[model samples]
Target: MSEKILFVFEGEKTEHVIARNFISHYIQKENKTVIKISFCGEIYQLYKKMSEDDFGIEFVDLFPLLQERDENLKKYKRDDFSQIYLFFDYDPHATNASNSILNELLDVFCQETEKGKLFVSYPMVESIRCYNGIEDNFMDLLINIDEVAYFKQTVNSYAHKKYNNVPQWTINIWSEVIDLHCRKANLIVHSKNDFPEREVPQDLILTKQIEHENKSNNVIVISAFPLMLLSHYGEKTASILQNLA
Candidate 1:
């Protein structure tokens, strides 16, 4: 039996890199654990990757509901796992349908858990752009998460007209974003003892073991963004799940 997680993403070019990196790191570093990944919503290439990769993790890039339904139909039902982790960005929409999707997933996981299903969920977290640390002289560090036009305008005004390559700007900006994302994830997983008390479920029974096996999984949600956090600890998270099972 292997541990699994459902990886949900917006599936942009940047996101694709993150997913691949996560899978690569986990598979190489942690042999004890197994990951089953699935992608959903407005994505195509990820489905291609999922098909091409021989890794054990499942990947699907369809509507979230359909993806979950497919997982349920598989040999591993919703109750078969130890945890279900949802990853998504906040979208500006009238209905905020992401929450609805998340809730449905939780409902299924919870239903199965109550029926002696071992799975649990950590819901209602998001990944958005924060300041990437490339502040000084780094004209390429464009903030692409939100306010895209504004971010580009700022980049254009950096007074460095000599460098006009779009790819350079994208790379620089993405690198900074990726680095910040990794830093945040590290802090969250590393700082379990210092987290402020909350009324909501702050930790799960699975947390301790997951931390022991893969310390990065315990970090705050931000670090997991752009999938760097997962790539760093994917195997470890899987190992913990496998060990627990």
Candidate 2:
């Protein structure tokens, strides 16, 4: 039977494009199918409307939510997918940029096999490939909250010319991106200046970034796309990332 993975994306174009490159390069399963669904609104808005009895985000079923916003998801069932992954941005400028809300959402959606795993791209979805042409050592890269709303424009102006079309990225280019983000995730979470040795939970990364934001008011530059690839594909992808170093 073919393994089916459902990708729920907030930034439809960017997330799907980046995911396509990674999926095409790293996913070797001959019988694997990827079903993509895009959410048109901010995740915080979803949290606000869906809070439960205790004003806590207890139940979040992405299938129904996706169906509510997109008419195409009416036929898909939750059980049909082997795994479910969600990709969203950390838009701190939003009116509902509360740490508690994001933390609760992260806690509830922690399991990929069950409820689904949520991966957040710090600041915005463009962080996955917002590598500036001049800054090679971007592990310490941090962007202020005030400037976050304009991040997509910054990426358009500063990111390497080649990254303008992420969907066209070759395997070698994808390998480089995966390698860069894997190491950056380690630095952001564990404060280690090396590649991640083991899988670090997305919630942990979120917690740390939240703490950092409280203190410094700047969010680290890390993307959920590469980490998602590393988590799902494991060492098959890691081996390629490691060799690139």
Candidate 3:
């Protein structure tokens, strides 16, 4: 049997397009693993949907005080997927006001970390574009930065306008960019803290308030997509990435 992995992304268009292309290429090359991708609109919407479906937790239960049932919830079985991953951005909800909801979602996700992973990109998904052999400059750009402004001026500037049309080519460029970034930095394993204010604590512990929470080793938090990609595909993939670069 082939290994099955399901990815829930925050964006419907760009993420879905990129994931489809990347997974298609990956499947063609490996021919053993199967991947599924879905978009759940925004991060908050995705969180609500995953909580209700994957964990069987209701929206009211997510926030006992707030009574809002305007949205419909879906049902999900654990056996539906071998692994589940949530990809989201850290910029919009990094402030103190949004931290409560963020922490709540994190608590829910951390419950099944062994079977579910949370992959967050700082600022936004476009930050991955910064990985084109300029590790020092990329690192410098991240220091003491205004998340919104930086994203607009720098990250969004590199956003591929034709991403939806030619996702394979876009991802190929990303792979090469990451390969160059890793080689230039001389790092075998990239640190998860490469993104500012987005580190998953090594000693993350769950509180007792959540009844459904469980101790799990499944959650794999990452700041850079290249690290995850290279690690998953191995050094041979790196050789291919270099040639593409």
**Candidate 2 residue 45 C-alpha distance from true site, Å:** 1.6
The TM-scores, one per candidate, come to 0.36, 0.90, 0.54
Using alpha carbons, what is the TM-score of model 3?
0.54
lDDT ranking of the models:
2, 3, 1
Better of 2 and 3 by TM-score: 2
Per-residue lDDT of 234 in model 3: 53
> Which of the predicted structures, 1 or 3, would earn the higher lDDT when compared with the native?
3
Best by TM-score: 2
Residue pairs that clash (backbone atoms under 3 angstroms), model 2 = none
Candidate number with the higher TM-score (1 or 2): 2
Which lDDT tens digits does candidate 3 get at residues 27-91?
A: 43554444444454455665555456554543323212111221211333446445555667655
Candidates 1 and 3 compared by TM-score, better number: 3
Judge candidate 3 at residue 180 and give its lDDT.
43
Per residue, candidate 2 scores C-alpha lDDT tens digits across 103-222 of: 888888888998888888888888877886444556767889889988888878868887666887777777777778887787777877666767667878888888788899998788
Model 1 agreement with the true structure over 1-245: per-residue lDDT tens digits: 44444444443344444444444433324432433343444222222333454652132322344345345325544444444443443331213323334333323333211321111211112122323233332211222323432433443454244332323434344444444443333334454322122211213322432343253322122323433233334434333323422
Which ten contiguous residues of candidate 2 have the minimum total lDDT?
52-61
- Give every collision pair in model 1: 22-231, 37-58, 39-60, 185-223, 188-219, 188-220, 189-218, 189-219
